[model samples]
Target: MAATRQALDWPYPPFEIPAELYAAWDARAHGAAAEAAWQRRFDAYAAAHPALAAAFERRMRGELQPALAAQLPALLDAAAARTDAVATRKASQLALDALAPLVPELFGGSADLTGSNLTNFKGCVIAGRDRWGNHLSYGVREFGMAAIMNGIALHGGYIPYGGTFLTFSDYSRNAIRMAALMKQRVIHVFTHDSIGLGEDGPTHQSVEHVPSLRLIPHLDVWRPADALETLVAWAAALQRRDGPSALCLSRQNLPVVTQRAHADGAARGGYVLRDMAGARAVILATGSEVSIALQAQALLADAGVPTRVVSMPSTTVFDRQDAAYQDAVLPPDMPAVAVEAAHPDFWRKYVGRRGRVVGIDRFGESAPAPALYAHFGLTAAHVADAVRAVLGTGAECAA
Candidate 1:
C-alpha cells in the first residue's frame, strides 16, 4: 500500500479529525515549556548547592583537577631519571600507579590482560554496581571495553583508557574511530606491539597494526622507544583534550635512550638522538627498532658513512610540526633509511623516493624473539645494509 501510494499523484490525503490526536499534539507542543520549568527547578537546586554545582561544571568542562596537574611534573621527572631497561608496558604501569592515586579522574582497565598489559595500578579497586572505582576489569571483551571507554570520554568526568594486544585492535577499531570522530580524549594502550612478541606465534604478533592505527585521522599513534618515551607518551595523551591516542608498547625490555636532562626533545615527537657532522645519511626509527638504528648508525660510521639516528616515537605529532623543523630533522637532500618492525608503507613520507625502509612485510614465526628478528632480517645488520645500499646507489648515480 505504501509503494502504491508513492506511485499515486497525491501520496497522502491529509485527514486529522480525532480529538485524542489533537490532545496528543497539544502535549507535544508544550515540551519546550516543560524543559524551561525543569531548568528553573535545576537553577534553584544549583544555587542552594554551590560547591556541588561548581564540581559539576568543572567535570562538564573536561578540566583536569588542579592536584593532578601539579603532580605531573614530578612524575615526569621521576620517569626520566630511571635508567634501567624495562618493557614499555611496565613503564606505563609505573607511571599509571603514581598518577592514578594523584589524579582521581584518570580511570582505565584492560581486556582480561591486566597482567600482560600492565594496565592495572596499585590502590585501584575494581568497579562494582553499588559504587564506582578507578579501575575496571573488562574481562575478555575488547570491543565492549573500547566502547565503554568512549562512553566515559564522551560523558566527560573521566579520562578513560583501556588495554589489549596490538593485534586485537581490529576488534575495537570502530569504537576507536567513533572516539576520534567525536574528538574524545580516550587512550588505547596496545601491548605486545610487534613480532618482538614472539613464542606466541604469528596469531599474536602485530606486523601491520602499528601502521594500521597510524592511518586513523585525528588519532595520535605512539610507538615509544623506551621507558622514558612511554612516560612522555602517556603525559602527552593526558594533555591532549581534542583527540584520542594509541600507545603501541612492547613486551620485551628496552634500554633507556633519553635522560632526564635531555628528554625535552621527545615532546617534539621526533628528535636527533645522535648526530654526526657532515652526515651522508639519516636513520629514522621508533620503538625497539630505534636501538637497532643506533647500532646501525655505529656500523655505518665505522664504514665512513657518517650517519645520524632520529628517534621518532609519534609520527602524528611530528607531522604537526612546522616545515622548518621537519626539514631540519629530515633534510630533503640526505639519503635516509627508516627501520621499523612493522609495515614499510608509511615510512616513505619521511624516507622519500630515493630512501629505503627496513620493515617486515610478512607474518612472524613461532620462535623466540631473537630468532624471529633474525629470521625476518630486523636487526642492525639489515638496517646498515639498507643505508649502505641507498648511499651506494646515490654515489653510483652521481659518478
Candidate 2:
C-alpha cells in the first residue's frame, strides 16, 4: 500500500486490503442493487410515518422549529413574573415542561436523582415492559447516564440530556470530557450546585465542580441566577450544536433579581443586571450569589459608594463576546469583587490584581444553607466589605 501511494504520488493513504479480499468484497457490495435496496427500506419507513420522517429530516438538517424558538420569550416572562422565589432546579423543571412537548427530538434522563434534580417533565415517562418512553431511568449511575447520552447524541435525530447532583459530576467527568472532545451537543443538568445544598455537608456540596467543569474546553457551564436565566440557559443549550453544556443549578430558592428586559443580554452570558450612575466598583456574581451581589450593591449605595452589579451566568460564553461588549459589562478600570459559593481561584482572572474573591475555599460543613453562607462569609455584607476593601476605602472582611 505504501509503495502504491509513492508510485501514484498520492497524498492520501493507500487501501491496505489484500487484492483477493478487496475484489470479493467489491463484487458482493458495490452495485446499483445495494443502493436501491437501502432506498426502498427508507422510503417504506418514510411512507409509513410521514410526520416522524419530516421531523427526523429537520433534526438531521440542524433546524429548530420556529414555534419552539418563539415560545422562549413568553416562557422567560412567565418565569420572571413569579411572585415568590424559586429554586433554579424547579425553574429548570418548568422549562422542561414547556419545551419538551414542542421538541420531540429532546430525550431526557437522570442518574437516579430525578426528584432532586427536577429533570423530568410531563413529556418524560420512564419506559415500561410493554411500552416505550422518552426518558430513561438510569438508576444511580452518573457515569453510565452521561456515557449513554454521548452515544445517543452520536447516533443523531435526538438531543440527549441527563441530570445529577453537581458533585456527582466527578463520576461522569470522563464521558463529559469525551462529549466536549467530540463536540457533541449533550446537555448535563447538574442540580444542588453548591454548598447551598446545606445539611448534606461537604459530601453533597460542590465547591470546585463548577470551576473544574469550566476548565473543560468546548464545554459551556451556565450557573443561572433566576428562573429567567434558567430558561435562557436551557434554550441556549438546545440551540448550541458545536459543543456540550452544563447547567449548574442552585438547590435553594433564589429571588428574581434579573429583569425580563435584559433577557437578550442574559443570552450573551453576562450583563449588567443593575447599574448605578457614577459607579465606582463592580460586583460579579452567579447562581444564588447574584441576589447577594444585588444586596451588596444596595449596601454600597447606602454607604455612599455607588456600584454596578453584573450577573455573569456563564463566564465561558461571556469570554467569547467581542472585546467592546466584554469591557462594557466589566470595565477594566473598575475594581471588581466576585462572589460565589465555590473556589476563589477561577474568579481571579476577572477580578485582577487589586480585586478580591469572596468565596468558600474549603469543604462545606453540615448546617442550614443560610448558616453555611454566613460561616463561609458568602453574605452580602462580606461581599460588600470585599468590594470596599478592594477599592481601598474600608476594613477587610474578617470572615
Number of the top lDDT candidate = 2
Q: Relative to the true structure, how large is the alpha-carbon lDDT of every model?
A: 0.87, 0.91
Model 2 bad stretches (over 4 Å): 1-17, 23-35, 128-130, 395-399
Report the alpha-carbon TM-score of model 1 versus the true structure.
Answer: 0.89
lDDT string for model 1 (1-399, tens) is 676757864444567445765786786558888999988987988999988777767777887678777877787788878888999999989978877776667888999998899999888878878978878889899999999999999888889999999999999999999999999999999999998888999999999999989999999999998877888898889889999999999999988877665456677789888999999899999999999998888877776779889999999998999999988988889999999999998899988888999899988889899899888888888888888788873321110
User: Candidate 2 lDDT, tens digit per residue, 1-399?
Assistant: 778878977664445666676687785556678898988987898999998788878987766788887787788788778767999999999999988877878888898888999888985778656787778889999999999999988988889999999999999999999999999999999999999988999999999999999999999999999989999999999999899999999999999887788789999999999999999999999999999999998888888899999999999999999999999999999999999999999999999978999998899999999999988998998998988898888664333
Estimate the TM-score of every prediction: 0.89, 0.92
Give the number of the best model, judged by TM-score: 2
State the weakest 10-residue window (summed lDDT) of model 1: 390-399
